[model samples]
Target: MLIERPEANAGTTGREREMKDIIIVGGGYVGLSVAVAVKKAAPHLEIELMEAAPEHVWQKDERASAIIAAAINMLKTLELWDDIKDDAQPINDMIVTDSKTGEPVKPVFLTFADRAATNEPFAYMIPNVSMVRALRQKADELGITIRHGAAVTAFENNGGHAKITLAGGEEIATRLVVACDGVRSRLRYMAGIKTVKFDYGQSGIVTTVAHERPHNGRAEEHFLPAGPFAILPLKGNRSSLVWTERTDDAKRLVESDDMVFEVELERRFGHHLGKLELAGGRRAFPLGLTLSRAFIAPRLALAGDAAHGIHPISGQGLNLGFKDVAALAETIVEADRMGLDIGAMDTLERYQSWRRFDTVRMGMTTDVLNRLFSNDIGPLRVARDFGLGVVDRMPGLKRYFIEEAAGRTMHDKPKLLAGEPL
Candidate 1:
């Protein structure tokens, strides 16, 4: 039997402690969101988030996240949606165009984002910095320890709890551990979990551009033979662009001079919103799909990009992380109510079961879309565009697609994802 330590009286009346320390690995979107969700479910739980970097590296890029509807509701539950909502640009509509030489072959108007609000937006274009700031601030208020410049160099899971050794030589003992450390998670490897992943022969180039005319809160996507060129609306007359191109060409673009890059960008970005002048810095990321073969190992579990990585054709990276947070939080909370060990493989498997399929499905969906739309085949283009047109005209089908993009699909949503933590 394990021995319990007695609580010390700290100059106050008798009140038992409520929190049990839980160590979280990494401080990215996934790591921080998991901490927030866990604390929201059980306010008394002690949570510590570790980040190896001194400052959040996410600030290096000027890209923004297309906040899905479900993720917005999650921010609401954490009392943070109101804070960053104003900085966001709601995607009221989306336009798809073809880069083919002939006249318009494929043109479909998308109204999925309006589902996020009954009549408002299906999703909002919130900058990476804003979301990171908001999550960091919320962590402070929720009493979640934010440990910057900290790394878990080594760890041990004794089938019951995880003991982590930090780079600074400090040690932490926690009953539960969540690995939100991105696709290159050492914790997952150390836990002896294998991963399945494949790299797409493409690279995503992210940057911000200022247009001559207002986007009017509208987004645009250009389907080129090379890959998808997505322009999500941003505040003012600026928009964030995610251009997926051949890996070799992407390398050249990243290294191209400002003038050379601008000319190439103009070709990819038509003059719908008028002249597009490059703004912010440009960065490229090789595309891939990575999923942990097994999500739960003993007292440890994985979430966010650490659990899975997918193509960004649909802007679902952070949203997927939030989904992981919601499901895991619910499972742990429900287990708490049942008076069971929240970190046990049996209990953690509930979260794994609840989320793995969706991750796989989404990863596959993005992969399929990238391949189907990235090719120059005329027949396939005609077919895919025809499919888009058909869906756009079908209200029921359109509504269903809209709701799914909004993250309101009822089929596999967990309790916390539905805006009520169990």
Candidate 2:
């Protein structure tokens, strides 16, 4: 069915309808993050976050998310950082290496521990459950409507507002609708938007490991011919791993028994972590990048994974989403103060302009990184390895890459990320 994407009707009442100020569809990291950020900024705004699931997927989403410093500050401004801060594993330094041919590629020390001397840690490792739990608690305390099991069955948007029909047959109207749903956001499809997608033919097998040796807060990134293997430090004696592999190999690994699986896992993850014992159930997610054709259409906007998905090579996926949270929240709050509909095209474009480049650029950069590291070409291997060595020797250039990974300098500067918004 061809859904109509209409412009605002002249003289449409912004708040005269029955809708909440914003209706966010998805309760994943993206959705919940936006809900918390926006509601924290404009408390008087009625924000309803509707998830189709029966309850928060705290258990299913055992995946670990890297809470970069910029993202941490956004949560801090929303008063959400302290709630889950203890559950997070701080990243003091990181190591990147090439393990395929016994020759080391670029290895540089990351100094995010003091926020590149800016007085904050670079990033923290947080589990999906911890963040969801924290947000749920904060949302309850803030009085934002956290509606689970309520999926939007249909919707009619006319720029000024969106009339949404729920699965339970209830209807509501909202001035703005932000889709923070996953890569396959139903709302984006319903809005009749197109996306550019390219699967990397790789699958990420993620799980946590309990080891005999302490990580000492050193995260490792190893580039192999197949894909990137990341060992992100977790709470004492444990580390979270995202190992990318060929799709078929990924399937076999996920389906394999623990004993068989541990062997393959240890090959990519060195013995430095000691005998790795699985601390969490193993799962797989396909790797790809998807960029929406457009991020804003008057009353509707897209944020987080709904707008773009990136490769996990540099572990910037969640950080990018948090960047979205910061941009959209700031735009909406500024617009609201001026008595302008926060959903207006002009207001929403601020967010679109703020986020689209970072998402697309990061997506492209990660994709390039993936392709460069996951191939077995001799000349390419030599070139990339030398490049890494060159960067490692240059302190100034190393610091630049480290800062970029920390999400300190994004194309869109939210005041909170710039350490000014709060």
Residue-level lDDT of model 2, residues 1-422, one tens digit each, is: 11222333333344333547789988877788777776776788889888888873566777778888878877777677788888899888877777672342334322332245475557889988888888888888888787888887776786556777778677777788888878898888888889999998999999999999898888888888889888898878888999999899999999999999988887777677668899999988999989998998757889888888889998888888878877888888788777777877878888888888778888889989999999888999779888877777778777777677777767647887765653
The candidate maximizing TM-score is 2
Clashes of 1: 3
Query: After TM-score superposition, what is the CA distance of residue 305 in candidate 1 from its true location, in Å?
Result: 0.2
Candidate 1 lDDT over 1-422, as tens digits, reads 23232233222123212224578899887788888877877886678888988875766747799987777877877777878988999888777776552233445534443444366476899987888888888888888888788888876775545677777666666678888888999999888999988988899999999999998888777778888888888999999999998899999999999999998887777676788788899999998888889888887889888898898888888888888888888887777667777777788888888888888899889889988988889888778888877777787887777778888884678765566645
Clashing pairs in 1: 113-121, 113-122, 114-122
Q: Worst 10-residue stretch by lDDT in candidate 2?
A: 1-10
Give the Cα RMSD of candidate 2.
4.6
Error in Å for residue 310 of model 1: 0.5
The runs of at least 3 residues in candidate 2 whose Cα sits more than 4 Å from the true structure, single-residue gaps closed, are 1-17, 101-115
